[model samples]
Target: MARAEVREVVFRIRWRWVRLSAGVGAALGGLLLLWGYPQVQAVLVRSSSLRAEDVEATLARAPLLPSSTRAHLGVRYLYDPAIFDPPRALEHLRRAVRESPFDYRNWMHLGQGYEAVGDRARAEAAYRQAIAWAPEYFLPRWLYANFLLKHGERERALEAFARAARAHPEAAANIAELLQNEERVAQLARLVPEADVRARLCAFLLSRGALSAAVSLWRDLDWNEKAKLGLARIMIARGISTEHYALARALWCALGRRLSERAACSDDLVWNGGFELAPLREMVPALSLSTLGVSEEFAVPDRDFDWQIENEAGVMTRIAREEPYQGERALRIEFTRHENVRFSGVAQFVLLRPAATYEVCFAYKAEVRGDPRVVVEIVGARRGVPEENAVLFRWSLPREAGRAGWTLVREVFRTTPETSLALLRIRRVPADALADFVKGRLWFDAFSIHPIEDGVRPAEGEAL
Candidate 1:
């Protein structure tokens, strides 16, 4: 009898628990259905499946959706092919905008509504209002910029588009799209004035193997590795043309920016090896001089000057304004009078195949007081741990004790089997190390490096 009573109580408790769970599930489902109403209209509008009456039914069921969604619905009503009501949309969106003056999206939607009705003046006013309400936001400015472009306000539109790109980089991807299409290149290039934007566009062009279009765009632009790699990868595949080969060489020389990381073996693994490029001091990035009239007398800085000047306590380096044997510039280093800097000059770390022969070539002139010589050494060590330095080869050239002309120095050697990364460091003879007075200026120009394949002809270019 007790067991039967317990069974009856267990059945009653299970029934109550099931009822409670069903009620909670139904309530949650109702809330979820309500929450999805705003997005439903947007999805329907995009898919062209929503009618004016359908939107009205949604709004009637739920009035909690934002003014922006309501305004958006009105714009949707304007686009329905069979029996659309743009005038009604204009009114609905206008009322929404008035009620929510700070809502930037509603303002954009209202602009679209006005534009649908041929009220362009009012459309402009609404877009301008949207921009004014949220100046830093990208969407309002992007919409306004596009609207201005259609109305022949192109110059203003271009500047606005640049601002939008700056405000958000993702917008640049869209601008890049317009530039990628060959037909749109001339049109957009003539207007958009941001190097960041153009570089991305150029990168896209080169990646897609649109060499003709890429080259044309490049002539108007500047040195870009991401873009250059696109060229280099093509060369790797299609066999490099002479013009393509030179560009590939230049960019390969530039990626020498990293030292500690083991380098992937390539032909020339020297950053700015020729010293043809340098960063412009203090200028915001702008459009490619393709039309901007920027002089091509300097290394176009992708970020930092490809060749980094080592900063010790008493050393300074600059791009030599004179005596360049290659494109335009060379490196200039100044050692302070009477100050002892143990390591002062330029250094670049490069990857070399272990047991493979390589050559370092450079032309340099020194004007010094202490008969301080210049030492170019290849040391087997990674960056930041010079204590592990292993001297591979050292070329010491006596900086003219008297008046001497530039001397060409070349050191060729085979890296050890364990030496995958090495530093090409240039510095003064050790008067600073020996605690003696030292002061001088060293000018290095026309630096280049090449791997020796069979050890016969000069694989590296002439450091003329």
Candidate 2:
């Protein structure tokens, strides 16, 4: 072959070989990239679905991913556990937030996670962050407002509701339903200066059977004359049938006054006259109405009177004497034998009118060594007369040892025609004492009974 031909042929073969090699390399590179893509995706998906144990293992292996991520993983793992692990969930949620400060969803999830874990404050912060990042999102605002409501931040909840309403006007019906369910409208009516809002609240409260609150709010707002009258009417209707006749009569009297001012009063006054105070001569002629021997009793214990200790629990031996009534007998209660003890007795009194409302007042000072639950019971002449009436009223004190200095306790009893004989009894039950073990003692004194018609007397050192 000629020299030029030989050179051309050699160059052609070398060029073809180089091109083939390049093509093979490119094909292999594409295949490798395709193979690696799924592995990378698999890693992410595995991380997303990582079991609590796996995440925990990862956390142990890599402690530098930040506390927030660990907390998030921990929360996820505990989300559906047989037992709720709030502390662990809280720790992980907190850590997740700390690790990813700018992630909005992270904050939202963290807030929910914190709530699930029972960390209210942190949950609130997380929700606030979520709201800050996505101001238009209704879920965060709704959740945050609910949280505020749960914490008794009614005003803040209202503000949050307003914001949520603005963001999601389409959700107005739902929001209204929520507000109604929460009695939000009623709450707003309490503090809201807007007349329309107050009216709405009044209607809501009335519907919810919160007549007293509704009436008070109505009087404050002065929104509806008819609504106010209606409220009073309902109250009168309900109250007159029960022991609440006195309260119902009072409300009716108020209504009568309103009617008189409007020139609406008439013969109706006599029908509502059930609440009128009777002449002293007519009510209790034997008490000498011309020169009644009425005396005001002070809460302070008289020096001449002596107190006695009665400990049913045998474990309590020595009683401690404190200030004021120091020398008076102190009752030591031992809760070792039983979880609760009842101290009770009868007071001397004769009911002039068995059907009248009698008001009982007394002062008690309790130093509870354990859990103190003091219940005062007044047995009416009627037996099995409902638990509330049988017990009259009960005041529960915490389990602590301190001088609860002469706290006044009052109970109003409605005597029936059947109640010819009645007795007053006060029982103190210690929480820590067993049914057999009575471990606490309470001091009670200055018990007196007066007709509710006479009005409540002032406490010690005060003038009525």
Candidate 3:
């Protein structure tokens, strides 16, 4: 062996090591390319690709592997902006569905994702799939109706509501409310005559607790006898008063001749049989007419017995005086200010029965002021009464010049078992302390009280 031979061998060994290192580096580069291609594709699909750092950060916060790790990962990806490329999100959701096809929640989320991306047709298809998976599920129907409403397909929306109502009668009220709130109904009504819109409107109104409006609309519509009878039935179910029933009766009589002519001889037979009237009597109970007496001189100015004040400017007119029956002097105070004031009063009335709910109504006018305030104070021995005057209602009206005529303000109060005499007071706050109470004139009108039906009242023969 020689020194030159040793040097050559050493050089060859080093060359071999370099060749091996290069080959390993190339293989590692290929592996990296394979790993990065999907992420690159994701970026192409949606400009924002889920970054590795984000995925790592999320995984760091989430509970590590579990039996349902894949599903949780899917949800995380679906919600994570870095991981949630639209296409990737959809893929995750699809995987979630495949893993749990019977899961209504998964399908619902899938549908919601599609809807969020504005793929309505696909979203609808997904909703239908969810319904098919769980026919008894109420949420899918509600979602489907929402889709129909968004697409401006109102008839379809109504049909969906009908299905939802039938499936969940308890939700009938909610469905009806949705229908009534839909703007399309009004739009549709404009396209057709009032008669065509009547049934739908009645159904909508009845569902939304607009019983009075529905009954009024029903009476004016050209419904057939059976339909009219059904309307009356619903009205009775809705607790329409005798006054409303009397109005309905009058309208029925007025339409009697025309109804008979439309129905021909068969219609005449039904009308003569009094089948319609039979249900009216059976479903609607008669209300007893009762008169309520007050100490002050008050007149029922409207059908609802609204009271009014005549001479507001005349301060000589005693707003407070004793009534003939109970000897309770009524005090009336006129407000002439731009700002709201706090006024207090105590009522002296002998309650024939305790525990009755009473409605209190007052009329006031707002004059030109920056911000006019109105407050009502009811002080009585009722339990749970506030230490300060109990504020039943508060209103702020825009201060404009002159008087805005009379506006009715009302509140319903429940009287306690121990309540005897109640007090009512109206107060107006001046718009500004520096500004005089000019043009703040509020006309104090007639004040009246009525007991609420079905409200708790003292037993008969009980004295206040």
Which candidate should be chosen as best, given TM-score against the real structure? 1
Kindly list the per-residue Cα lDDT of model 1 for residues 1-464, writing each as its tens digit: 45644444343468888999999999999998998776775645643445567667666665655676678767777776775789888877877887788998888888888888888999999898988888889988888878887887866776777777767654565755543466454445545555655655544554444555555555555445233333333322221222233343334433333221432324566755666645321222333323212223311222222344756666677776676656677777777755555664577655566788877778877667665666778787532233235887787756443344666766677888876556677876455356565577777776666788756555442323
The runs of at least 3 residues in candidate 1 whose Cα sits more than 4 Å from the true structure, single-residue gaps closed, are 1-49, 57-66, 179-199, 208-243, 254-464
TM-score of each: 0.40, 0.32, 0.33
Q: Candidate 2 at residue 278, lDDT?
A: 20
lDDT (CA) for every model shown?
0.61, 0.52, 0.47
Put the candidates in lDDT order, highest first: 1, 2, 3
* Residue 306 Cα positional deviation in candidate 3, in Å, after optimal superposition: 21
Clashes of 1: 2
Put down candidate 2 lDDT per residue, 116-158, tens digits, no spaces. 7677888898899999998988988988988887888878998
Candidate RMSDs in order: 20.2, 23.9, 22.6
lDDT of 3 by residue, 179-236 (tens): 5553543433333343433455555555445556666667666655344544444444
The alpha-carbon root-mean-square deviation between model 2 and the true structure, to one decimal in Å, is 23.9
Q: Give the TM-score of candidate 3.
A: 0.33
